[model samples]
Target chain A: MNRRDGDTCSSTPDDSLAREERRLGWTLVAPALGVVLLVAIAPLAWTVWESFHHHDLRMPWLGRSFVGLANYRELLGTPRFWASLAHTAFFAVASVSLELILGLVLALAMQRASRGRALIRATVLVPWALPTVVAALLWRFLFQSDAGVVNAVLIAAGVLDQPVVWLAGTVTAWVPVILADVWKTTPFVALLLLAGLQGIDPTLHESAAIDGAGRWRVLTRITLPLLRPAILVALVFRTLDAIRVFDLIYVLTGGGPGTATEPVALYTFSALMQNLRFGYGAALSVTIFAVAFLLAVIYVRLLGADDGRGGSTT
Target chain B: MDSLAAACRASFLLLVLGACGGGRADPRPVVTISGSAVGDEGAILRRQMDRFMELHPAVRVELRQTPDDASQRHQLYVQWLVARAEDPDVLQLDVVWTPEFAAAGWLSPLDRFAPEAAAFFPATIEANRWDGSLYAMPWFVDVGLLYRRTDLVPEAPVSLEMLPALARAAMAGAGAPGGPPPPAAGWVWQGARYEGLVTVYLEILTAHGGRIMDDSGRVVVDDPPGVDALTFMRDAIRRGVSPREVLTWHEEETRFAFQNGDAVFMRNWPYAAALLADSVRSQVAGRVGVSTIPAARGSGGRPASALGGAQLAINAHSDVPDLAWLLVSFLTAPEQMLERAEAVGQLPPRPALYDDARLAAALPLGVRVAREAVASAVPRPVTPLWSELSERLQIALHSALAGQVEPGPALHTAAADMNALLERSGLRYGMNAP
Candidate 1:
């Protein structure tokens, strides 16, 4: 960065500036490392350590006794934990699958609509831009059994003879949460895909059209392949988010009607906050961090390892 | 390598904290008391603190505004007490938590602070005493009471059997006048699967010859009477007396329901009456009246109400011990009892405060209904595991309210889980063993 340091820092010029620059190189990266150490490494270590200890919320400040793998044993043994894991899996997988397909379709439709794409794009972001709690409350009101508009509309149309407890019963509760999540986040995916779509050259599409490459073939061979990186990015972003979902589930269902919609976040929260089992909660937290961390590493490696030269057609 | 550095850092922090602690020889000593910032709290806090300051020239009472929900406030207090923060010297404890908090050694035992604790109401005093030590002083008394429209519903709901039919007829148009009845009203209360639901249920359960746990800690409520109590709750909704949607309601939602003039009757605490009255924001302003949950015939017991108020305790770590005790005394004494009660619609913790005619008028039913409720109130179990018990009760009540399982099975399941928790906590009772 110094004037005398220039490009030959391995053998610096005999100037004070070059010597100072060489001395400051490591110092420049120190702040970033300090931040990472404080925020991530320390807490991550504490969480891992706490997972092996017996801690409860009532005596939150006391020294935790190391209990080896007992907390993890209990977590794995819990029917509640397994059921919640299944519920979270279903939520993330089903919701993300739907969003990806819908987002891709929307991006394709908007790609060629050259007129007013900006306005249309802005309109799509409205759902994504809403605060989560506000979105949840709006959905909860509309989905209420008695006063909710969805039930009222359904009942009026005779689709339901009796009012269904949208947020009450377990099987029925996830529908609204999934619907809310998909509605709020799919536009985000669409916008990303739309950007990717815009980045693709127009002449290739025009040539494909002139050569009688049909719409499906052009999409399959050219657009979809080229958009793979964008799709992977969106998937990575959303999957991580959907795994740790708390606010919506807490506000809407509160992990209720017999723990049907309970996810790991709600599970760990009850352990920590409600049950006052801080050590056990720590175990759950560590487990989730490990699983999610593993998933992130897997995706980054799998996707990053693939060459940018992926399949595409003109 | 890091251990020596960490020790240095710790000593440095201690020196900094110690120096800061010493520099504060300020004449004004601050004492914090937790109270809701609702109703007339703004005026009442100013007047009471002014009196407190005048009485003790060195003391300054800082009112820590607590949320209306006692449970949430209890949570905050738990965090403070666990961390042993010096501020918030006076803890306003939920009546049930007084025992649990006392047992945990978080509160300064009050015999050392106020030796005149014997003058407190027997029940209120008993509630504050844990293992022969009074760890807290009473701030106010609260009991869950039934609120009904006086003009429309019958003046006295004599028995539990008559309430559903009466609520329905009045709501469905059978010459009910004061209650929000006749096609416009709904029956409202805490129906969400939480502590409130269990509290409401216990009010009816005890009235119906039911018991949750026997003197020995054995499960006693898994019988016909318990089912009847739960069935009555269901009947209220199925019979169109209370709305089915009440299952999702908490205090605020129910308050909104009754205050907005949509409910014929609401079961709540004494604080609700003040809110209903000239918050003429409240629709059923003049129509509301407080009474006991209806008693059941041949139930062996009188109507039961759940105790739901706070007690002031000195945080054991507080440096201004005398100031904290003085603040508690000033707030709960007979002279300022009305000021505190009228400031907020809390029932006076001191039974003697009920004797004041002026104070009685401000609270309306403070002297009468509250006194009756206090006379036969039930406190939640005083075990250290009360937190766990409360959570289990919420789940059981939720299951019952959602129609997931019949009430009897749910209570049985809850009792089993509770027994396990109690066993886990190393609490042994002779009679609790089958």
Candidate 2:
């Protein structure tokens, strides 16, 4: 803000005109700033404040009192909290990586398609159009042990003699969760990448082909380098979403077979809503916000550096 | 534009004033009771509320609908009570929640009303008392029962060891020539990781002479008996007596499996008996039998049933405590309970009603079976930390049953966590104080 003001002052010799412009800018942006403060900053501030207190709705006799960082201390000490954080990181990395890979393949395929391009793109978005909870429930039904279609097909194909209880095992439970997430969100990532793919100059690919470059060589050298920004965008979006996942896993496995698939957001919800431990829940919320913010900042930095390099290369 | 904005603001103020004026026009004392109001439950509650309004013409009784799901309803009630809303004067509490609510000071003590506590079953009344005072009135009782196919088993198992054996034999005998198709599994219960799972574990634990907490409120769920109980449950699945799929089954799923003649033995609540007796929907309609869950052989444990039911209590923040008590007393009255039993198959809390011939005709399982089950009913530990404690136990039980961890280690972890929770909340002292 200071540099922008300095530039305005230096560019314009008239001091009063610059002052008037600054005032007008403030006036024009006041409402939006007020809304951000009200909706975002205020709740975030309140949650941070709450995290330092001791408040349990179920135990009213304990009374609401400021306890410094006692809630945070307890949260950090909790094995479940650490496990949930690990689960969230694992889920975010696994699901987001799968989505990115599958999405890139879909985007490339869509770009190569000549006939019925619009129809193909629209039809590919069918899974993305379905609600997350609905999609998760569909996957759950398909994976059910006794009568699910997954088991039926597997048995028919001589894959197994008996149906496997997917949700009953710790490792097996994550299959449906990650698959549901990827199924529901890969189209979104593909759409983003497809936009980036379209923006790449056709001349670049044409020149590379005239030079006897193979399709794979052209993709690696030109298409992929240009798709960096879009991939980063998809990664940031999917990672943030996967980190805060609740309803999909909630509907499918309920974070169970013993909280084996529980994410930090689900644990925070259990603390806040189910157990009514507002103070500790607020601490969990603040921690998740910090992690997401840190990741976003890192991604934005990478995007900025990539933009600068792309400008020079072009 | 200024004039239009002024006009809208003026009309909004008038609307608010009009609403307040309308509320003031009703001079009668309004009492709202919130509980399940879905389908038949809704119809029965409406009828009862209408009768209540008729008896007390000067007051208005309103039926506010709450979520039918217990956990959702519990969260809603906590939010409401924490905010101290006065409209919902009466609350229908689960038996396990009475202590939690009372300890939180969200429920008004009912001792002042001089309720005939002796008239109800001792265990039912005991569950509602907190700190030597009655806080709620037992409305109806729900006890877990061992449901077996009478045609397959011929008689109830005398011991827990014999139950799975009988189930295995029944499964082998089910597909005889010209008989019913082969049963899929031996036994089924609510093994899902939730409150239902805890109740199921409690029945098994008690049957093996284990208690979650001793009388003095010390955590004893990791004792030898508890280990034996969990091992028995785990081994049943391992031996194929109970299906591995039960790990995902809740009450309804188990009921569906048993009602379809897929299982020879099932464990469930009294509510299932009514649905199971419907020949159109149930494959083994006339062949079902109810018995108390049997004790483990040589464990010196008695046949036990996990106690569960609903209780009526006055909201502590209510404006009309006396009127709320009146409604509570009325609903828990013997006649009303019997009516509820006949209409919905909810077992009356009053032991005296078991002798009534009408209950036998009304309840599909008959009064004798219900009486025996209720007689053996053991309440989950009465503590304000019951929800949290039960959650931990559910995880442990589910982990062991799912083969994620051994029963001993899982239960030990649960006990340690629960004890720490109790200590941190300072409820241990409150619970153990003489």
Candidate 3:
């Protein structure tokens, strides 16, 4: 009837087909785009806009005088901000580095046919499952300078004459916080790396053995190169998490011992939430997000990592 | 004819639905109030709330339990206040917030409600007043007091100067004849760097005949007397007469240490006295003694205690201010105040409630401490801007104690910041060009 049904719309097929393709693709992706805009894009935009205004909780009127970059300028001059950034960088680099190494060892340990492997796997998930606050409180109790078990043991063994306040001085507060973070989040890193290790075929290891590859050589030559993507993914994920840590440090020490434990997130939190300086808090948040995003960019480019869910494996 | 009948019935149903959903008395404002000490005695608050509801019969009240520590409570309460949602009509504001919350305009002033407020303790009354007006009504009161182990010392701290030596001597006695030093704390206080720091610092300053902010409300802590007070705090800590933990101890920790008979002298609130003397936990229950914080300098400048209490205020924006004020008044009435004091450990908001023998018997020591402390308790500066000034005080006191900066500079910093805050708030600090 319309120029024979099988003619494939000879006059209008390409244009119609193109329109159909665009409609189907866009409709399929529209929901995901909407979700991203609602959550990530909208809040980010709102925070950026709020950063330019000066306001507090008492009078919540918007659109004050445009004092461009003044809030950021004031913050840069403040020692607390600079110190907190230094603290954040130190915490991120130290925690993530320790986690990466510890996670590798744990995965390697689990890879071997060790007794109680299932039990260890099950128990390893406990720290990962426990709320961050719970872990912090437990560790805080253990580290109490006066009556804590750690100090008691040290004193009883004649190793030291008296109990040292593990969280007393600014320099020392880092120990308890990093120790808590490592205890709670190291398991997550191990679990991710373990998945990668397990995904590698055992035949590859067997072939390396047949080729007279030593354990060290096999690990360096085959296992590590194969596990690089997983490691990179784990590093990126944990680095982001470590940088934004709040509850663990908040509950453990409360950014105390003279603000030695003050991380950037905690600083922004105290400024915005406790101090009720909304505009300054927004500026600080924007700075943190920018730094974290830059770190992510550096990680992806240098490691050249890809998501494992893609066509190729580690 | 059948279709017309069906249409008539559908329209009737629609009319009923619209009537039911569209307009009515508030279905019940779901309110949440947090308390740490309510415990099993929470029914007292509910029953009192029920009495308020009887007069109105429509407004509902709910009380939520919060942890006792003010810092932890500060974190959650700020989130709610900042959000400024209208559901929580009545808030029990900490006395320290008289400046901060009032300055922020978060509180609805009591002047709008026309409350019957004459019976309240004048200090408590004055404590709730911010600027030239009253913002809240006293619901209860708590003030810091000094506690000592009678076995160690039968007298009050004779003077602020004598405290360090007395603590050292008391500790030596507590140590066994040949055994190691006493496992117990020697002296305990809320030396932790927090809002509590402000309360304790002001107590010392007032005792020393120094004012943090003067009559005209200029920052005046940079003087010699202020430095002397701060020096005493630093020396007390450095000498180890007070525990290293004192630098970290808030009310509960210090209370725990002192109540366990570990401390010879402890500075804390009166609530700890009952718990310590009760057979359940304390070692020095009968042996414990109560008094004021040591005198500052001469007889003229007597020791001043930091007043800690809460109040009930009607939300200005509330559609039912009458009912809200009604609820607030009933909760603070003498009869309910007596019940709240007896059950929830609240010191009565009214001066006359102190005459209730039954209430006193329930909280004997707490009442005694309240009467003595409130008589001379200097309210923290009631200027709306004092909250920012308070944080500056904390930083000053802390840095001075840590030996990071001299007390002179620390107080100077506090003064400058306070002056700026006061200026921004449209208030004059005394030193203005006038």
Q: How high is the CA lDDT of each candidate model?
A: 0.76, 0.88, 0.74
Per-chain TM-score of candidate 2, chain B? 0.92
Q: What is the TM-score of each candidate against the true structure?
A: 0.86, 0.93, 0.86
Q: What is the lDDT, from 0 to 100, of the residue B166 in candidate 3?
A: 76
Tell me the TM-score of model 3: 0.86
lDDT of 3 by residue, B34-96 (tens): 444344345787777677767656667655444345555566566656666553567667887
**Model 2: which docking level applies?**
acceptable
Q: Between 2 and 3, whose lDDT is larger? A: 2
Q: Candidate 2, after superposition: displacement of residue B405 in Å?
A: 1.0
Report the C-alpha lDDT of model 1 over B89-140, residue by residue, as the tens digit: 8877777787667656788888876457756676677777766788777777
Where in model 3 is the C-alpha error above 4 Å?
A1-19, A59-63, A114-117, A199-213, A305-314, B1-37, B51-61, B64-68, B71-84, B116-118, B174-183, B298-301, B354-362, B366-369, B399-434
Give the top-scoring candidate (DockQ). Answer: 2
* lDDT of each residue in A1-314, candidate 1, tens digit only: 35663557554455666578877986998999999999999998988888898876444334467899999998898767898888888889988999999999988888868799889989989999998866887888888876789998999999999888777676788889999999999999998998888888889899999999999999998888778888888889889998998888877777776566889998888777666677799899998888788889988876776543453322
* Winner on DockQ (1 vs 3): 1
Q: Rank the candidates by DockQ, best first.
A: 2, 1, 3
What tens-digit string does per-residue lDDT give for candidate 2 at A184-301? Answer: 9999999999999999989999999999999899989999998999999998898888889998988889888998988999899888887778999999999999999999999999
Native contact share for candidate 1: 0.25
DockQ metric for all predictions? 0.20, 0.44, 0.19
Instruction: Quote the chain B TM-score of every prediction.
Output: 0.87, 0.92, 0.85
Candidate 1 vs candidate 2: the DockQ winner is 2
